[model samples]
Target: MIGAATFFDGYTVIAIAYAMPVLAKEWSLTPGQIGLILSAGYLGQLFGALFFGWLAERIGRMKVLTFTILLFVAMDVACLFASGAVAMMAFRFIQGIGTGGEVPVASAYVNELIGSKKRGRFFLLYEVMFLLGLVGAGIIGYFLVPVYGWKVMFAVGLVPAALLIPLRFFLFESPRWLASKGRVEEADRIVSRLEQSVIKSGKTLAPVVEMPMAARPNAAQGWRELFKGMYFKRSLVIWAMWFGSYMVANGLITWLPTLYRQHFHLPLETSLAYGFMTSAAGVVAAVICALLIDKVGRRRWYIGALFCAAIPLGLLAATGATTPLQILMMAGLGYAMLQTVTFSLYLYSAELFPTRLRALGTGIGSAWLRLGSAMGPLVVGVAISGAGVHYVFGTFAIVLLITGCITALFAIETKGRVLEELSP
Candidate 1:
């Protein structure tokens, strides 16, 4: 259910990127205006991550997830009615709150459910739905945008509202969250129910092993705790990872369609097709990461991914991003490399803190994600207007290089380590 919700979240978030080409032509939007419209959603996402992350830690994940889904769905409908840049920006900003809030909290919730064995693979496989959602938006945009128009992008986003029913009625709150709150009995009840369901399928259960109790910090201290103790360094590292990866990844993904159409004079179909291909490449890279990250280890995988991405981006800048095919092939590869880092950071972030802080910490860390996401498009706008498109790739390559160095020096490996053991 969470995966399904995120699928729509992915679709709705990137759908605007697909719509931008037509909207730009129709509205005669300046590059700056286009950046503002794109940035608005991500800016809204920053607040949403903070507010909703804090709320989930208090009220529980399921309820907050429900509210977020409803919020974005309604705003998506509102987007269908938007007639200009200002109106679209306003609607997307409001809608971003919902999409932004859902992922990190959902990441925390899902992470808490599984054991250490194959945890990287399991969580990342779930994370792939969001990437698929990006591809879905691109596919929809490729076929539908030219015929049915931009409004159709917003219209298809409405489908996730139906997910609310299953979310509310069928899902239980995170048991690890309950246990952290000292509601041991309630947590045990939910766990027992899961165990019983597994036994009913004729699988024998392993004997329970006692694990070290994770520190339950005062939940009320909230965001302040992130800056104290072991978490302080962890927080900084993850935040840097989130910001650097997202800034480059989203900058490329969101602006590529419009850039192709406006800058290269490609037909609408070709532009959307190129964008979709980039997204598809990212999905493939992400799946490969999902399959192998556990053995490679988190710290090494991230450091390698970051450095690998820098190579293509740096080359693109050195060579000058002159041709459409050149931009697509080089930038697409760079985006795919960063995509692995961006998609898996939630798993890494949640592992960095205890349950008491997991959702909140992930939320706050992802706020940097929102900031980077917002900045990426704006930077692209400024770079294109001033230094030319090649300089955009040059800037991203520098960011990736710095981030890769930081990860190499400081990041800790979390693969196959139990959450409680890793953080505590």
Candidate 2:
């Protein structure tokens, strides 16, 4: 159910990117205006991550998740009614608040459920639903946008509201969260139900092993603790990772379709098709990362992926990013490498803190994600208008290179270590 919710979050978030080309033509929007429209949702997400993440730690993950799902779904419908740039931006920004809050909280919830042994693969496989949602939007845009028009993109997002029924009825709150709040009996009851379900499936259960006690901070102290002790450094590194990686990845993905249509003069269908191809490439790369990240280890994988992404983006800049095919091939490869890091950060951020702080820390870290996401398109718009397109790739390459170096020097491996042990 979390995965299903995340899928729509991805779809709704990027659907605007796919719709931008047509909307630009119909509304006669300039590059600057287009950038604002594209960025509005991410800006809304920044506030949502901070506020909802704090709320989740206070109330519970499940309740916040349900509210966020409903908020974004309603905004998705509002998107269909938007007639011009200001209205579209307004609707998207409000929608972004919900999408932004859902992922980090969901990441914490899922991470708390599994043991560290298979956590990377298991969580990442679930994380891929978000990428698949991006691909789904691309597929829909490629086939539908030229014929049915831009409103069809928003219309498709309404499908996920139906997911709320299953989410409410079938899901249980995170047991780790329950225990951390001193609701021991409630946590055990939920865990007992899960164990009984496993036994009924005819699989032998592994013996339960006791974990070290993690520090459980009071609600007032959770936010303050993020800036103290070993957590302060971890918070800085993770925040940088979120900002740099997302700034480049989202900057490229959101602007590429519009760039194809306006800058290169490609036909609408071809532009949307090419955008779909780039998004599809990211999904393929993400799947491979999901399968292999545990063995490679989180620290090493991030170091390698960041540097590898920087290479193609640097090449694109050096080559001047003149031809659409060149941009597609080089930028697509860069986006793919970054996509691996982009989707996995939630898993990384959650692992960096204890249960009491997981949602708060992840939410705070992802606020940088929203910031970076908002900046990317705006940067692209400015670059295109003043310094030219190649400079945008040049800026991204430098950012990725610095982020790669930071990862090599500061990041800790969390692959096989238990979460409590890792954080404590």
Candidate 3:
């Protein structure tokens, strides 16, 4: 249910990209203005991730996840009443902040609950639903926005907001979190529940390792450990990786609908459908990566997807304002591969650092992610304005190429490694 809650949140935001054209007309927005609106959410995401990441490292992941989701509920509802572009932008930015924190913290929390052998499968299942949220968002915009207007599109956020409160009632503390916090008895209690749930779910588990008495978190050291010594290098690499991927993802996603309509001379409805279909491909890759990550190995997966992605984005750049199908197929591959790499990192970022700064470490990476998201659209928008849309796609191809090379150069493989075994 927590996973279901997150899926809906992801679905809503990505779908909004598809709805931009209608909103732009109804609200009278320009390309540069729309870019700002798209970028604002990520600006908020940066702050939200940093603060909440630190909070999770200190106060605990589950509690912070609940609070953040509830905040998401409130901000999403506020979006329904937004009357102008500025107000709508403000609401979306705040809504994005909530989502930014909710997702990474939740990923760390849930992955910690499940055991190592099945962790890949558990996250895969969770992300599959997350992608479904994208499909649902696209579909909702496709049908409802034509009749009900964009406000109704936002009103639908209520459904997930309602679902979150009840689902959280049954939530438990993360055992890894408890174990790290010196609450071994509590850790055992949660781990037993996890063992039971996995068994009842009919998933196989590895032999359990009894908690060592000495590995618990020391309160005095705090999250500052993330920036000290060896931890700093890992943190920098993860941050660079996340920043690059997010730059590509947001740069494309936020402006994509408008790009389609303008470049291909297509109707709004067709653009929405195209967004839905391609993002669905991304859904497939994300789920597959999550499912196979433990089996395939992270370093190999990251390098392969980055290289594969660069090819399509280059092709997309070469397509140069062709038919909708051409644009969709070319750009869709980039989107899907981007998502594959992105989802793989959800676990990777958290896995890279030691237990003490797991959230902070991931948060540090996500901070750059939001920065990328914030800047990507703005930069791409300028590229389109100064040159042509072809130049923008070509530029993105270069970015992807750089991203792939960097991934090959820097990332460490962490397949099948124990969570606490990761060092600072």
| Distance from true location, Cα of 291 in model 3, Å | 3.5
Model 1 residue runs over 4 Å out of place are 218-220
Question: Looking at candidate 1, what is the lDDT of residue 111?
Answer: 94
Q: Please, what is the whole-model Cα lDDT of each candidate in the order they appear?
A: 0.93, 0.94, 0.77
> TM-score for each prediction?
0.98, 0.98, 0.93
Model 3 alpha-carbon miss at residue 228, Å: 2.5
Write candidate 3's Cα lDDT for 175-230 as tens digits.
76777777999988877886798899989877767644444445676666666666
C-alpha displacement of 268 in model 3, angstroms?
1.7
TM-score of 3: 0.93
Worst 10 residues of 1 by lDDT: 212-221
Worst 10 residues of 3 by lDDT: 210-219
> For model 1, what is the error of residue 277's alpha carbon versus the real structure, in angstroms, after optimal superposition?
0.2
- Which tens-of-lDDT digit does each residue in 365-399 have in candidate 1? 99999999999999999999988999999999999
Q: For each predicted model, how many residue pairs clash, with residues at least 3 apart or on different chains?
A: 0, 0, 1
